[model samples]
Target: MAKYLRNLTCTALFSMTLPMTAAAEESEVQDMSDPLAVYTQAGLGYTDKGINVKVGQTYDTGSDTSMGMNVLEIKGFAGEALGWNGRGADDSIDSIRFRNFTVDLTNGLGGQVDISWDFDSNQGSASYSFIQALPKMGMFNFYHSLDLG
Candidate 1:
């Protein structure tokens, strides 16, 4: 009976060891030489009374760098009221569009340019544009403008 018990213990230990060896062989990490890529997108919307606004951004990452674009649209009753009530109501009747272009250096640096335009039902419109650069640290410079028609 003691010999039989020892044989049973040896069989159980051998079975456990076999599975562990097989798992290790199957789980080895592969070598990867290609650059990694990533992509991202985001959207935001807000509404109050007759006003509605929406904004969205997207980015694409490549081998050693990345780039992105942003879009914003403003419309609805709130926009209409503000456009009409404000000094530039006539040109504000149509939708307002904004766009941003950006680049990522992949070395902890990047830059961007933004532009915007407002349209009216009567063919009148206004536009403004700006550009910015990135620094290693501290506050970066920015420029902006507004056109009331």
Candidate 2:
């Protein structure tokens, strides 16, 4: 019975050593000589850093001079104005807005005209112009275009 117990103890000890040896062989040893190792160990990557603040302003100027015909005759508008917009990192601040603009019925068919500009992260600034005939049409249809930059 003593001999049997001794054999079992030796087998168990040998089996434990095999797993330790295999694990050591399978694992790789990293080179700590790299300068950025310390930062990497502290859970920092390429884009990880401090607060990033972005601020800027945008200027836009446009002009239109045309005497064209749609389904009906249309007048023309010729004016010059300077406009600017201030922005922050996100849209958490006020955006580009037009205030106190006057519209006069100089000639031709009277319609509803709307001009809007918005900012987006992926596609940048977008400007939209829409013109629709007033209560003349129930379907509410006219001409529209979008300028994405």
Which prediction has the highest TM-score against the true structure? 1
lDDT by residue (52-126, candidate 1, tens digit) is 454554545453465565656565433333222344333232455665545444543333344444344434243
Off by over 4 Å in 2: 1-123, 128-130, 135-149
lDDT of 2 by residue, 51-83 (tens): 112111111213132122111111111101111
Q: In candidate 2, how many Å is residue 119 off?
A: 7.7
Q: List RMSD in Å for every model shown.
A: 23.6, 32.3
Q: What's each prediction's TM-score?
A: 0.37, 0.18
In candidate 1, stretches whose alpha carbon ends up further than 4 angstroms from where it belongs are 1-50, 61-64, 76-93, 106-117, 121-132, 136-149
**TM match of model 1 to true structure:** 0.37
Candidate 1, residue 141: lDDT: 36
lDDT of candidates 1 onward, in order: 0.38, 0.24
| Clashing residue pairs found in predicted model 1 | 50-78, 83-89
